[model samples]
Target chain A: MTDLYGVVPEPLAFAARDWGDLAELMERSSSDLGGQGVGALAPSVQAAASAFLTAWAGYAGESAAIARGFSSALDALVADATHTDDAIDTHFGGIDARLGPAR
Target chain B: MTVTIEVPASQPTIRRPEGQPGGSDTLAETLYTAASRYEEFADEADQLLAPRGFSGQGQNAYQAAGGKAAGEHRAMATTVERVARAVTAYADTLRDLLREWQELSDRQDVLDDRRTALIADINATTDATEAQIAALRERASALAADYAELVTDHDGLHRRVRANEDLLRQVFESATSLDEALSADGGVPEFAQQAMDRPGAPGSGATPEETRAWWEDLSEAEREAVVSSYPGLVGSADGLPADARDQANRVLLDDDLATLGSKADDGLITPAEQKVLDNARAAQQAMADADSFEDPITGERPGGQLWLYDPSAFDGDGRVAVAVGDLDTADDVAVFTPGITTEMSDVPGYTDQMQNLYESTRYNGDGSSVATMFWLGYNTPEGAIDWDTMTEGRAADGGERLADAVDGLRASRPDDPAHMTAIGHSYGSTTTSYAAADHDLDVDDVALIGSPGAGPADHASDFSVGQEHVYVGRDSRDFVAVLGDEGWIGKGGLGLGTDPSSEDFDATRFESEREDRGSTRLDGDAHSSYLAHDTESLYNLGLIVDGHGDQVNTASQSYDPWYDVPQDPEWDRDPSSGVPGQSQTRDPGQP
Candidate 1:
């Protein structure tokens, strides 16, 4: 138990940070593409392309929201574990005082 | 990590996780195994360390040091084991949370996939795009709602685990404190005093279970001290076990009798004091007589035990209770309350009735032990025949006391509780009914014999035990039974409520028939003949006290039919019309 203390696993944090970075990159890439080659398409085809981009943006936004939620949950879990560890330490200290020096 | 991605012309393929780590089954099984291991360690530690804490038969310095060392080790081991158990529980909670989180994540994935498909369909067709987008929005909203519920559930589990850990810590601390106190010389008394002075005192809203637990935790010497010093507190407290109350009350009774008897023997006392002393002596004599009194039915002398006695109670009217057998261990017990005109002086007669009922019940019980108590624990009315004496005021006061007595009995016998019944005779019935109605008295069955009415209740169903367990017995010719219904002519009727034996009251009517038996005109003897030997009333009462409800002979005939009638017409006739004026006085002489 003592060995596991203060070890907050960063897998969820890493995933959330990576997902946010990817979403930003995607938005930049889409903006650049819209400014260049996609500008030359027929009106109907351009309209369809714009609709697909909008759908992709929505999916990216939702993914970013989910990643944030997971990051917050992980933070809360770490806080809980820290509190439990402190409580266990205080309890053990009191027990030591009552029982005198451990053999 | 940044990626250059290509937008699909139609729809992007949805990705699913190849494998999920730490499934619910694996996590739960691991937690269970840890918990089991901790429990096993606790058991083993207790076995190893508990015996060491006990000092061997030597009081030398070396032995003392060894004992102190052992005690410390024991305490440390116990604390470690308890902490381990708490950790196990916390781990189990975490396991549960992990399982729930996994399920929630799976649900979120499914919802995400649905939203993605809906969004793709929206981009595919212009006509259906609005509906598809709306469907996608609904799925997203559902996912948010599910996430909120999952968070709430997780928070609740977290709170529970924290609360459990706090409780474990508190228990461990309490045990340590108790051990330290025990090690100190003359600390037990101080500890007991502190416990007694704690938030919930003996009679102040502490439940019987709480009282029993507190009592069990005390050492024998501490228990004795509490009983001796605070007999009244222990004796009358609602939650204390019955045996403890009995012990405390018996100690008080003996001390009281000795003091009162010594005062009387000194030969200098007021009339009032004399009466109290006399009542105390009478109670003692009754107890002694009960010891010698042979059971006519069983032919075995079961003797008696005094559960309660207060000579100075009721402003010298005195209160006394004598059980014909050991009530603490009895399988079945009945507490009979005597009504009007009962006093400590009547203990002999009451105890005789109790003894008879006890024997009858024991004989009918098929080897089951039965204890019957003659509880004269109130100042009954001074006059037996006065209508004013039948008021509900006395019954109400007596009812509260009766309720306490029942609670005391319940406390005394927490384990293997007796099947208890309350038998109230005459005004006692009114008192018992008041107890049943107003005080919520804890009794299994209630029998109202020769009762005028049940106080405050027009029907037996109005009582706490309901009509099913309410037994009524009244001889048809008993004149006292009518007084409950007949209001005071000018002041209004007796307000004791409805007669329990009346059909409208709807109680189980048992036989109280008092017919002639040989030379005895038992039937002619009304009101008090219900307890006569060999009477049907006593037989049925015995059956009820023994919990043989089906065997009780219920009265087939109704007593109310004959009692409910108009005033006689003869009393309303004109005073001047003697024999109808002799038909104008002509008869034989004029002819």
Candidate 2:
């Protein structure tokens, strides 16, 4: 039985666990490829991102209804982070904006 | 949601928000949105923490990946703002202390109780500023911890970001392979791939420390097997430390060919990928070399030298009165700065100025122990000075150049790290005060002689002179010292409240002497008489040089630092100041 006050329900329920698992996968993948290329370095970077996602998801899980809103927003951010180069290069009609000083 | 109101601070019912006005939005949203909108406002601060992609760089990418998670970097930004506010508050506190101190000093007779209270206030203010510094340090430490966690999670994020740049170069190198082999039909490959294959880019390599560890982790049998397999690699491993040798052996013997095959199977071993990996390694090497030095003064690494000077010639020139003295029988070494258009060759002569005064000083009866340096070597521009050209803006180049020179001096004389005093004459005073503020110099006092302008207003908190003790010397007739322009002369220039030369000047109020020349009151040549009224100014000068607090003498005084004399104002006035009927002469006996 999901506790209404503390536990999340169904798909939104595993939001924290899913993010944590993905973060762990990223770290393992990075370590596996440590010598072949920069991929080996990915796990370390992904781990922090994973940890942060997990924490945020856990915070929202207390109120499962709100988890959907936060998780969807997080999913969008992840998509943005992965497609950074393409989003930056596309220039027009891009979602993720480039950060830092102008040329 | 807009509202406006004014509230009295004394009201007890005033409501305040628990947090700042920005609301409890998650850290990620704030950082991401700000970066996305601003896009181009990265200062030195942006790169201060971990170097890599900010969420604003690509909104869609961040959003798709987990925008809120990436946006969490905003917490670090808040930490930085908190630290900055702390420093600003400390500066404001110092400013207040200066205002209060100046008011209390103006009274004709500063009672013992008042002086004691003022000192306590100064101590309290300093303590408060120190507390702010501590708070900033704590915030900075926490931010650093967060950043370290980020670095760990990001794994090779630093290497990868840099690798992307290198991979671009490599892709540009092997055009034939990149154009035909990768795409099959000779369609031009993307610039990103082109960049990866470019030669002369950063290579994939671990840090020396990491390499050392690799060497240490290998077994002897494995190391030998690897050494036999790769001859050149083995020889390179010899000069390396034990740890590096072990790590090198590990890479050679670890039988990592299986992993490489898997990586290739996963399509992760593309030419672009290899190029980026190589680049990351190269960047790591460069970063390691850069962090080796901590001292800003002598820490010239890959860059050009900031400044350099040789003072060996001063020792040989006997004409240069050289005496290295220790202060008050203590170990505190002192450097005495005498001002004016002094050339490098004139450095030795100024040493006599300190030595002569030191001989008469009660602290320096023999003038042997205190190591006093006469810094007349700096090349000062010879011409009438203007405030605009002396300070920031266009004159900032000169200021930077001068700062570099002083830094060079401090670096060269590290052995004698003593409390220093810069005794400036006329324009030299301006330079000394300006340099002190700009550099956060270790000098104890900036004693001005025949000064013309105010001290540096911008660096008051950074200075040790407590803003008010930016000491000034003037005579009533000295026209140049009293000249005012743009309000800088009276307020910022001398750091003195009233003209020291005026007849009504109340020097005794601050427990300081009143002289036709030596007093803070403007008088005499108004421009030139510092070296003439030699004894009084020179004695006070000796006390300051000795690092002693200001001393007041009330009884009739008659003397000279270099020669004994009956107390009189004969030498105080400029010979040219007298009427036509009166005659002036440079007597052989009189100063």
Candidate 3:
């Protein structure tokens, strides 16, 4: 058997959670795309084509908000980690001071 | 437990947590940069994409793409703005925590040093003789004094830093709110109007310090908008900064001059309007020609600065005020109020006197900043001989305005108030005295030149200042001074009251002799010639204005038996009755 290892950071985990929902929405919208060319088309058909492009553009635009949310969540996570590490260091220093120099 | 005990050789070094992606300072910078980029992108997209929608068949496709791109860009901009705000808040919190850590570390180091010194001192004292202990005590006392001084200095620095931080925080908050408001559609006008209402509007009841702080919080563009749109409000409002007022007033003056000049060129002005236009033009010319009018004593160019200008004032006689130096920051300021026939047209003549006084005082002040202002804010009686309107009523009304102007000067330079002197000549003297006596005028000194009276005040003490601060100068040949002495002529008196230069009125009188200046004799026109160059009156006035009262050439108190006495009927009947070869008709009631 081959030995396997992986590391998934908390920020990546948060981004993955939002990426699943966005991917599903994009997949659904992609299936409804009109296959009409922009030559000698009826007004209704042109309107439908324009709407299709606008809808796809909006679905793509949602990624920016997702990225901003992920950034904020990662920032908070890193801050928490730093605080916990400091606490651990302080606790260990106290223990060492109390149980000084094993004879 | 007989276990072996060991102590650490040194204190442990406390290490801060590492691996933080961005430090507080870096994070703040990044957020600000992101915000700026988002704003630029949004602006560019709106400019390029918004107007090109659905123009033609080929353009329609492009327009559609542009519209989609612009919409996405705008949404991304909003998203980024939210992220930047969050990041900035986080950064600020981190910065505060870091500052706390730094302060703690600094305190710990100080404590460690003190502990080490105390231990050494303890060890030395344990084995020391009594004399050594006393010497150590003396050194410790000296150290205590040094520490006290250091603490005082540290407290001052800490307070300054805290104040700076507070100001920075206020500015940052204002900028953030302003940015948000400006990002909204059609928000600029609303924001500007709000700004005008709060701080830009005149008579808003904001204190000078508050107004100054609010002014500081504004951007340069915002300040320009306020000045351009609200010149009348800003130019005359008290409690606004002097430089701001001067800027606004200069703009107003230029615009007025331009408008009047255009009207005159078109020949559309009435006779009265033409006079006003001419006066404004002549004042502008005088300011331009001030380079040639050098001080006779120091030969320095005393360029006149227009402080106040109103071309359509007082039925188009035009009210104006000009200063010689920077009154805003001067150490000493003298404001001269001209009496009869003073108007915008006579500004050059009045400003000439002010410039002479300004230069003389500046030369005598020995590097002290001195400014002299020619104040023609009042509508003086039209004719030189108009005594009816020159009485106390006109002075009373003008007194209020004078008081307000003085108060405005004080308010403008509240941080560094100047030593102000109110000098009034002729009927202007009555106006100044009325302000001092009744209106509670704020001034360091009150000086009257060729004065008829001290308004309603019988003595110098009535002006709410020290008697020594009241200065009076009068040429004996000046006939106006006698008007106040004739009590039987008018209701109460012919003029305001008893002459301030009289011995009984108890004012410090300065010498003002009517003499010739080389070929020119200023004897008959002694009242107007009080400000003549190389005259004792002008020199004394300059000294008094510079707050050098001890250096003034004081006039000796010569007793006049007829002082304050009613004019005898015999003397009034014929001018030659008192002395031969002096034949002239007497007008006892004439001003």
Q: Note the DockQ of each predicted structure.
A: 0.01, 0.01, 0.01
In candidate 3 chain B, where is summed lDDT lowest over 10 consecutive residues? Answer: B576-585
> How does each model score on TM-score?
0.50, 0.29, 0.52
TM-score of 1: 0.50
Segments in model 3 whose C-alpha atoms lie over 4 Å from true places: A1-103, B1-192, B203-219, B289-303, B384-390, B486-492, B517-523, B558-591
What would the DockQ be for model 1?
0.01
Query: Per-residue error at A6 for model 2, in Å?
Result: 99
lDDT of each: 0.57, 0.34, 0.57
Model 1 residue B61 distance off true place after TM-score fit, in angstroms? 59
What docking class should model 1 receive?
A: incorrect
Provide chain B's TM-score, model 3: 0.60
- Poorest 10 consecutive residues by lDDT, candidate 2 chain B: B36-45
lDDT of 2: 0.34
Query: Tens-digit lDDT track for model 1 on B440-479?
Result: 8888899989886788887777877777898977666666
lDDT at residue B515 of model 3 (Cα atoms)? 46
Relative to the true structure, candidate 3 has a C-alpha RMSD (angstroms) of 28.3
- Candidate 2 ranges with C-alpha deviation above 4 Å: A1-103, B1-340, B345-349, B360-368, B385-417, B458-462, B484-534, B552-591
Which pairs of residues have clashing backbones in candidate 1? Answer: B241-B411, B241-B412, B242-B411, B242-B412, B242-B413, B243-B412, B487-B493, B488-B492, B488-B493, B514-B523
